[model samples]
Target: MNFSSKLLQNAVEEFGRLPGVGKKTALRLVLHLLKQQDAEVARFTSSLNLLKEKIQYCKECYNISDEEVCEICLSVKRDKSTICVVEDTRDVMAIENTNQYQGVYHVLGGLISPMDGIGPSDLKIEGLIQRLRQGAVKEVILALSATMEGDTTIFYLYRKLKEFDVQVSTIARGIAFGGELEYVDEITLGRSILTRVPYERNVG
Candidate 1:
């Protein structure tokens, strides 16, 4: 797509930098935003600015939040004895939408992807071990994706947590092997969580 204005092209390029957004889609979005009322566009940009400036990670679970701790971690309604572990904040949101989980979450931030240079030390694994050491949690549910990296991370986590008194489990493979948790249908994700399996080190 050729643009007559360098400014417009630059805007489109910036928008295209977002994950999964192609150049065509970015151009369409930038044009749409330009067509909107000035006040409306201002509001949209302002909201994004606020997000960039104020977004914070929950200290306990590593989930994205506006405060030191996420609302789910702070909620008394959630089950304190069970924690659903996920790869990131997006996974947390995905499971939350299913409404099948009443337990709190522990966001690892990323899977243990050796190909991608991500390791256990790069995630929130230590914090999780500390949480278990607190002696309040009875179970830890591994709600990672079905990818090899996810499986590897779960294995490492299982080894680290096997010594703990807490029970470790993984969501059922309702989704395909390579499917991400966020992309799975809500019903399937919910059912997977409901019918979770014990974390077996020999499965690999």
Candidate 2:
């Protein structure tokens, strides 16, 4: 790729550093940005700079927020007794989108993946344990992803919380609503059969 200007090349290289962005895509983005007005470009750069400088992590859950406590943690409507443990802020957002769970969240920051050199000590496990020890929480929901790493983390957490009085539960895993048994993976299909729930009608 032949970039006439070093400034343009630098911008393209920086954009290319982003995940899933190829050099060609980065160059295209840089060219697009170059075509924008100076004021528009300033606003774009300013927003990015502001995000980097002003974004805060909730002290309680480590979720991204503008304040010390996130809106979810501060909400009085949320169930303080039920803490849904998740891998990251994305999981927190995903569950929130459903509007089904009214419980508070505990973001682990990451899973315990030995291959990735990530362990319990590297995550927010200590903070979660401390929060539980305070006695306000009655149930700890392990909402980690359905993977080997997720299973390992859940098992490790179960062992840790065994002495605690809090009830431990996992989100039900099963076939999708419209999925056929033949298409569903063996592990999920088997678990779905074993943990089948009664078909209850919604009143509303």
Candidate 3:
């Protein structure tokens, strides 16, 4: 696309770099921003700048947070004995929307995708193990997506967590194969969580 202004072209290019944003969509976004008042544009950019500068990862669960620890991890009302393991903050948000789980969460940065070079070391597995070692947790639910990588991560985690006394379980297959938690509806996701099965049963 040709642009009369380099500033507009640059803005479009930058916006296009975002996932799922094509050049056309990026152009639309840039044009919309350009139409906004200067103060409104400043506020929008300021919020993004502040997010990049001040966002913190929770020390305990590695979820995105404004503080050193996420509110869920610090909540007294949460079930400290049950930890729901998810792929990222988005998955955490998806699960939270269900309002069916009182347990806290552990966010693995990503799943174990060998093709993408993501492995256990690339995730927050050790921190999760450490939490389990502290002995407060009684159950660890593997709430990863129903993809091959998700299954791989769950199997690896099950092996590692089996050494611990905690019960290792996985969300029910109410989710079809290859489904990501973020895209699943709240009711199905909530029911899957409610009817999780022991990880050992799926192994053989």
Between candidates 2 and 3, the one scoring higher on lDDT is 3
Off by over 4 Å in 3: 175-204
The per-prediction CA RMSD against the true structure, in angstroms, equals: 7.1, 2.1, 6.8
Residue-level lDDT tens digits of model 2 in 1-204:
888999999999999999999999999898899999999999999999999999998888888899999999999999999999999999998999999999899999999999999999999999899999899999999999999999999999999999899999998788887798789999888888888777773123
- Report lDDT (Cα) of residue 63, candidate 1: 91
Instruction: Single out the weakest 10-residue window by summed lDDT for candidate 1.
Output: 195-204
Question: lDDT, candidate 2, residue 151?
Answer: 93
TM-score of 2: 0.91
What's the lDDT of the predicted structure labeled candidate 2? 0.92
Best by lDDT: 3
The per-residue C-alpha lDDT of model 2 at residue 130 equals: 91
**lDDT tens per residue, model 1, 58-173:** 98898999999999999999998999999888898899998899999999989999888998899988999989999999999999987789889989999999999999999866
lDDT assessment of candidate 3: 0.93
Better of 1 and 3 by lDDT: 3
| TM-score for candidate 1 | 0.82
